[model samples]
Target: MRVAACLMTLCIPAVSLLAAGCPDTGASYDDFAARYDKINPGTTVASGPSQCETPLGSDMEATGNWLFTLSVKLNPKKAFVLSAAVTAEMQDDGSMLVDMSLQPLSATDQTTPVCGATIEFTDLPVAPDGSFAWVLAPNETPLSLCGEANPISMSEILTGLQIAGTICGPADAPFACGTVTGIVEAPLPDFDLTGSSFTMQKALTDGSFPPPVLNCERAPADF
Candidate 1:
């Protein structure tokens, strides 16, 4: 009886964690992005001339946003040791454009070209709650590394390599997809560096999975 009770006790917590689902999941991709403004990396609730701002383009508004830290993995095995921050603003045309900044939960010196700056996701439609659904589109310009045609995408900056995946909407959004959840056939090359293609340290695939847990306990207290 004692042994059986111990086994059952151990199993309960494991089952609880599994049943809990993701804690910081976005209602939509747009919802999670507010996390960035919460962290106040750049934009703030400043008033008058100096209000909510961004490093992307021009200042779109004065109302600041929130920053939610979520976990992500790369390739099939490698998880993002650091958490990434997402922030966004709506363009005049009603389309939403986002700015992703990678904050390697480790790495004290802060490296160059954080993973967030790699892809330029635009034309996403923001819902009433400010959450967005995004889809990747093909670019005429092929992305290359070392003069080799990587064939992924052309950056909005019209520069070097970028990666794109084929999700029409948020696969892990809090809401349900009523219909039209079909996958695209024969998709283009992705940024899966873990596979044959060269990696640029971005999300391996576009599907939203649960955020990863911290690999180390010694990580910064702020993290």
Candidate 2:
């Protein structure tokens, strides 16, 4: 009986630990979606100013009117990393166009081109509550500004953005998986443009899932 009791004591703690690691999935999507909507209101896009030629390196100076935002969530006190790439276009009608995509760099052990740094998971995680923000910079690279045909600088500048969320326990844990949420804002410059525009989308997909287009714009300046 004493031996049986000892075994039970060990099993009890193990079971409790297992329970603590499991996360709840009911509020997962809704929580993340709400945060996304808050940051990226559909009507933030608008028209602004025109582009002036820079004197130094013949660079075009342009600004944006709207802000972009993105949020994510993870569980089990594990690491979650993100990388994104954006593409812009000048519409024939004179509006600005943009495209954006995000990829998980360290969460699932995937490799990508934009994985600049790995976000380490901490006991005091920021997911589900805090977010990281960065601004969408001007197309510093030749490829960003001129597309595939023109290759200018090696570095690109992104502007006005934040990524925030929580890293909770595992899926099966009682503490529940933490959520990561935030926004990425990219404003546009103005011009006497008609149809010139751009689209912004996220590059990362869940695991091996197919890539998805998060946002798009044909006439950002018209918004």
After superposing candidate 2, which stretches have Cα over 4 Å from the reference? 1-157, 163-210, 213-223
Give the number of the best model, judged by lDDT: 1
lDDT per residue for candidate 1 within 1-223, as digits (tens), equals 0000111111111112111222221222222234323433443211101211221122232112211121112222222233233444656754344544323332222222232322222223333223232222112222111111111221111111112111112221221110001111112233222111111122323533233322212122122
Q: How far is candidate 1 from the true structure (C-alpha RMSD, Å)?
A: 20.6
> Model 1 Cα displacement at 101 (Å)?
1.9
> What lDDT does each candidate get?
0.23, 0.21
Q: After superposition, how far is residue 13 of candidate 2 from its true place, in Å?
A: 51
**Best TM-score among the predictions, by candidate number:** 1
RMSD of each: 20.6, 22.6
Tens-digit lDDT track for model 2 on 1-223?
Answer: 0000111111111112111221222233234344445554541111011111211111011111112222111111221223433333434433323333333332223233233321211111111111111112111100011111111122221221222221112222101111122221111222111211212222212323222212121111110
Angstrom error of the Cα, residue 217, model 1: value is 28
* Runs of candidate 1 exceeding 4 Å displacement: 1-75, 106-161, 166-210, 213-223
